[model samples]
Target: MVVGAGLAGVRSVEALRAHGFGGAITLIGEEPHRPYDRPPLSKAVLLGEIDSTVVDSDLGALAVDHRPGVAAKGLRAGVLETTEGELAYDALVIATGASPIRLRGEGPQHVLRTIDDALGLRALLRQGRRVAVVGAGWIGAEVATAARRAGCEVTVVEAAECPLAAALGPVGAHTAPWYERAGIDLRTGAMVASVDLGGLTLVDGSTVEADVVVTGVGVRPSVDWLAGSGIELDDGVVTDEHLRTALPGVVAVGDCAAWWSRRYGRRLRVEHWDTALNSPEVAAATLLGGPGEGAVYDPVPYFWSEQFGHMVQYAGHHAGARLVMRGDPVGTRWSACWVTDGGTLAAVLAVNLPRDLMQGRRLIEGGQHLDVDRLADPAVALRDC
Candidate 1:
């Protein structure tokens, strides 16, 4: 039985049967809707250019029992006790996913995490009201872009001195003009002291009036249902290199899973689409209790965002790294590579440059000792090396 039917769970179901695990598989998900693509929910779906149903996985084609709208409340050893009832399993995967952070206030505000939230926000956006978005994270920024496209005046309030300070750091945040040109009223270091019916009250006692507000502070893993479970928890379900949890016969993947990354030598929790797609491949192979083949999930963590017609691509993590920039931040056609103090590439972020992201992903995966001169040359093709 699968505990969640998001991208990871759906992928696991197809992969298990393909790998000759012929046992009866029951896929359980809390959301009533079929397993759908969440990445587009913030982009095309929000802009009303794509339907949510378009991304749902065709589980019936794979001949698997998919139980949507069923919430799993508890797990005991190899069995799962859901809000509906209980089911036994030889192997269980936890793909409960993450939930958006709701800011505490007099807020009847909307957040764009779930499909339901996206739909509700889309309806509210049709009124063409002014939107005040709190937090300048990727989700907040993307939602702001959607709001702008919907003809809503967007204002972003962030506590950090620069947008994306926590995730992308100063160099990346310097690309703020991209949002400014898109007509986003970005207010940095603006502490939200209180929220009222009229709008939000800043720490300086100024009010930003808005018809609607969205708080995209961040997301917390949906591991609250497994709080009683004996599995190790460190912000998310802690798993090994093989994606096995502290408990036997149970594995965790996707946004809810935090595993030790061999490449970065750190316990990383990635709430990314590709991580959800590929990480579970490791967990399924490890379930047999045998020496796995070509094991170890050391793939570079990657993510992308489309806002204001620019495809912003990021590969790898940039924690404690130097920004090796070779781009005109305003021109929006260059790439920036995050390098370690010793000069090894930690990550690469590109705007409107897919080739750099593609080849940089290979360099990261291969752990190649990059030629510094070649990488610095803007004219040299990455494939030429």
Candidate 2:
């Protein structure tokens, strides 16, 4: 049995079948619609470039008993409690994913998460509409981009000095200018006091009048249902290197699972499409072969964002790593590499440099040591570095 109809949940079901699990497979979700891709909700879906983001996988051909709109209320030993009733399972995969963090505000505030959210926001993004977006993270930037494309006057609010401060730290300063170049009103170090239909007022009493307000302030793991269910929960559902929970016969994956990473020597709960798409296979192997029987679930995390007419791609974890620049940040194309004190490549961020990302990802996965000077040279290849 699998809970969650998001990418992680659906992929979990597919992984189980691919591993030869022929028993009764039941998939449950809280949303009424079938499993769909989420990354497009902020881009193509909002731009009306695509009507539906539903995944192309055929549940019927896979023999999956998909039950949409049925949410799991609780869990127990070999039994799952839902809004409908309790169901038994030999093995379970928890992929409940995460929910967006909403701000304290009144009136209609938009958030880009579900398909309905995309379409609803799409309607409000007219030529003369004023759109105020809170938070300067990836989602916020994407929302601003879509609104600008729709001819809406966009204003992005950020409490920090630069966008993506939490994720990229000082490296985010490079992106601050991109917002201005795109004609967005990028206000940094401005705290939002309150949000209403008219607009949002900052702590300084300054106001940003807008017809639509969207919040993109990250998400928290949807593990509240697992409370008192004997499953460990910290930042997310705590899991071992094998993605197994404290209880036997059960494992977690995707955004909800903070699996131990042997490479980084920490527990990481990556809330991105890459983790949801890849981690399920490892969880399925652990379930089929029993605990401690399959390969460890540790991979170089990868994610990308398209905004301001540039493709930004990042790979690996960059905490506590020294930054190495391949080219000028103000340039149209460049790459940033993070190297550990041990001279090993830790992470890489590429801006309109796909080849650099591809090579850097391979180097990061192989744990290769790189010469700092060579890495800083734009003319040199990542593999040679």
Give Cα distance to truth, residue 223, candidate 1, Å.
0.4
Candidate 2 stretches with Cα past 4 Å from truth are: 290-292
Worst 10 residues of 2 by lDDT: 289-298
Q: What C-alpha lDDT do the candidate models reach, one value each?
A: 0.82, 0.92
Query: Candidate 2 on 187-247: residue-level lDDT in tens?
Result: 9999998887698988999889988999998999999998888999999999999999988
Candidate 1: which stretches are off by over 4 Å? 54-56, 289-294, 371-374, 383-385
Supply every candidate's count of residue pairs whose N, Cα or C atoms clash at under 3 angstroms: 0, 0
Clashing pairs in 2: none
Pairs clashing in candidate 1? none
Best by TM-score: 2
Residue-wise C-alpha lDDT for candidate 1, range 1-385, written one tens digit per residue: 7778888888888767666676777889888878888888888788998666444456777777888889998887877889878888888989998998876678567787778888788877754588999999888888988999898989999999887777788864765786799888999999887667867888898989988888888899999888778999889999888888999889898999999898889999999999889877777777754445446777799999887778889998888877666567767688888767765677888889999999888876666666667777767765443
Per-prediction TM-score to the true structure, in the order listed: 0.95, 0.98
Q: Tell me how candidate 1 scores on lDDT.
A: 0.82
